[model samples]
Target: MSRAFTFPGQGSQAVGMGRELAEAFAPAREVFQEIDDALEQKLSKLMWEGPQEDLTLTENAQPAIMAVSLAVVRTLEAQGGFKLADKAAFVAGHSLGEYSALAAAGSFTIADTARLLKKRGQAMQRAVPVGQGAMAVLLGLEFDAASEIAKEAAQGEVCEAANDNGGGQVVISGAKAAVERAIEIAKTKGAKRSMLLPVSAPFHCALMKPAAEEMAEALSQVDLKAPAIPLVANVTASRVADPATIRDLLVRQVTGMVRWRESVLYMEAQGVTSYLEIGAGKALAGMIKRIADKEAAIASVGTPADVETILKTL
Candidate 1:
């Protein structure tokens, strides 16, 4: 069966995410230690024993999620003898998870991925002041409808579709007023439910232009190699393997729509019949099930038992 490995994004993070993996596998512990060394912070501690507020901070959450995802990958490699290049037809991630996918596929070192995500989180947080920018979920609306609603709500401000997560879930982000307006507009337009998300900053919208610019500079300074498998990028929802092009896409992704639904569809079209969500949570697996709408094999590998279960299949 053709397979694709997916990674989770920001909202999937939680305290004690990788504690099980770290305890169960030496390689997992090594991954966490490497990330701690790279960032010069004991992030694993915060993740294992957190004040949820601190772990939820964008700067902390982004790399923390990546660290857990990589820890799982490392465990799978060591325990299952699984090789991504041999098994995965493609890899993809939502927002910051793209870096996790890249790190798993060997495009970037684990340490570099951790550091890059740290910088990305900080840049995104700094792009706009808290409360000035916001994001909202517009459920029961298609991407086209959500896009129009965001446009109408802009009112000379910046409101745009951010994440086209399938299952009639779309996230719009921009100026707080604009996003709030979009929520109300979505209500009038037959949305099942519309509510503002409690995000620190507007992500994946024009308001993140400064963050995009910052990422461009940050990505330029890093050495990125072509991945062992092609990545279905968020901005394009298509396969990309050229290192230079991938770097550019990562920059654009900061302010561009996360075409997650389309990306999954693209993978399905490419004959990816099995998807492994190798991360902290099963959020991506849930989305993939909705997106594919087929009897595709989907699994989440985050713990030792999860890893062993997948290994048997492998």
Candidate 2:
């Protein structure tokens, strides 16, 4: 079956995420060490022994998640004799996980990916002052319906659909008041439930314009290469391999809706019959299952044991 390697995003992070992999594989330890050196911090320490609040900070969580994903990839290659180009047809990720996917596919080096995500997280967090912006999830609603609710709730204040996560889930983000209004509107419009998310800032919306611009500056300076495999980008929900276009898309992704549902559908249409979520959590796998209606094989590979299982399959 045609396969895709997917990466998890910010929310997938948890304390002690990579401890098992690091303990079980030398390559995994090296990958974590490299990321720590690149970021000039003992990020692994915070990851394995965290005051949950500190680790949950956007800057820490973004790079920490990428580190775990790359650690898994490295362990797979070094110990299991697997190469992404030969084993997967495409690579994709959710939001920040897009950087992890690119890193796995060789579009960016592990060190560069770490620095870029550090900048991205910091930029996103700084885009809108805390308490001024917010995000909410609307359940049992389709993208089109969610978009209408965002528009109606905006009342000229920037409410926008942020993530079309499929499985009857759509996340909205914008100015706090507008987002609050959208939640209420969504509830009135037959949504199963609508609740504000506990995020530091409203991400993936126009309020993130400043973050997008910052990312443009940060990305332009990086040496990005075309992935060995094409990337199913979040902004467009389509495959992209050109370095210039991918760079542009990464910048736009800061403020653009994460078209996750469409991205999965596009991959399925292109003959992807299996999806491997190579990261800290099974969030993407869960989403893929819902998007594809369990017609495709889905696996989450984070621990060494998980790696061995996938290696046998490969």
Candidate 3:
């Protein structure tokens, strides 16, 4: 079966993530060390021994998650003999995890990905003032329906769909007041449940134009190469490999909805029967299984144990 590798985004982070992998494998430890050196800070330390609040910050969480995903990839390379160029058909990721996918596919080095994500996270957090923006999940609703609710609830404020995360789940983000109104409206419109998410910013909306501009400048200076495997971009839900196109898409993604459900469906249409989630949490894998149907195989590889099992499968 053809396989696609995917990565998780922000909410997947947890304290003590990647620590087990680091403790179990020397290669994995080196991944974290390199990321720490690249950013000139103890990111791994913060992730493993988090005062929770600090690790949960957008800046710290972004790079930390990328580090963990890279560490998992490194462990697979070293111990499982799983070469990325040989195993995967394409790579995709949820929101911030897009950087991890690009790094894995050779669009950028791990260190560069780490640094870029640090800047990206900081920029996104600073785009809107604290308490002025918010995000919420509307469960048991179609994406178009949820988006329509957001548009109606906007009432001239900025409310838009942020993530179409399948499994009847869609996330909306924008001004706090508009999101609050959306939650109430979604419930009234036959949504199973709607709850406000405790995020620092209203990500992936027009309000994030400032962050998009910042990323355009940052990405312009960074070294980016075409990936060995095609990338399923978040903004478009389509495969892209040209370096120039990838850079432009990354910029737009800051102010665009993460078309996650459509991304999986696109891969399925292209004959991808297996999806491996190579990151800290099993969130993406779980979502893929729910969205892509039981006929597709899903794997979560984050630790040495997972690598060992995958070695046997290979």
Candidate 4:
């Protein structure tokens, strides 16, 4: 089957995610070491033995998830197993996981990605004061309906759709009052459930303009090369590879809706029948099923056992 490699974003992280893979492969261990050297922090320790709140911090979670994803990529390429360039038609990532997809496709060095994500996390957190911004999930509503709720709730504030996750799940982000208003608006419009998300910032809304500016400067400093395969950008929901275009989109993504549903649909139209989620959790896999054909195959690769099992099938 034609396949794509995908990466998970925040909220997929958990303690002990990459520990087994690190133990199973020297290459996997090296991925963590490279990130540690780049950041000069014991992030792996935090990931392996987390005090959940600390590990869940944006600064830590961003790079930490990318590290585990790269570790899995390294392990799969070992023992003459599946080659990402040969086996995948495209690669995609959700939110911060986009960095992981680029690293997997050779767009950025592991160390550089790690450093960038750390800065990205810090910048995103600094963009708005805590509790001033918020995100909410409006279940049982299509993206268009959720977007309308965001617009109506803005009240001259900054509410906007952040992630159109499909499966009747769309996330809204913006000013706290605006987000709270969106919840009421969603309920009034007959949403099955409307609840606030526990995210630190209102990601992917006009309010994130400041964070987008920070990413613009950070991305300019980094050297991004063409990927081994085309990447379906989260913002555009289509394939892109030109380094300049990719850089521009990365900045836009900070303030653009993650068009996840359209992204999966685009991949399926491009003949990607299998989506391999290359990191911490099954979130992306579930979304793909919701967005595309339910029969579309899906898998995850983080531990040694996953690597071995997938290799056998490949």
lDDT per residue as tens, model 3, 29-110: 9999999999999999999998899999999999999999999888888876657978888899999999999999999999
Better of 2 and 4 by lDDT: 2
Global lDDT scores for all candidate models: 0.93, 0.93, 0.93, 0.92
Candidate 4 per-residue lDDT, tens place, 34-128, comes to 99999999999999999889989999999999999999998888855556898899999999999999999999999999999999999999999
Name model 2 segments beyond 4 Å from true.
none
Candidates' TM-scores?
0.99, 0.99, 0.99, 0.98
lDDT of 1 by residue, 1-314 (tens): 99999999999888898999999899999999999999999999999999999999999999999999999888888887768888899999999989999999999999999999999999999999988999999999989999999999999999999999999999999999999999988989999999998789999988899989998999999999999999999999999999999999999999999999999999999999999998888999998988894789999998889998998887
Flag regions of model 4 displaced more than 4 Å: none
Tens-digit lDDT track for model 2 on 143-192?
99999999999999999999999999999999999999998888889999
The alpha-carbon RMSD values of the candidates against the true structure, listed in the order shown, are 0.7, 0.8, 0.8, 0.9
Angstrom error at residue 188, model 1: 1.1
TM value for model 2: 0.99
List candidate 3 segments past 4 Å from native: none
Worst 10 residues of 3 by lDDT: 74-83
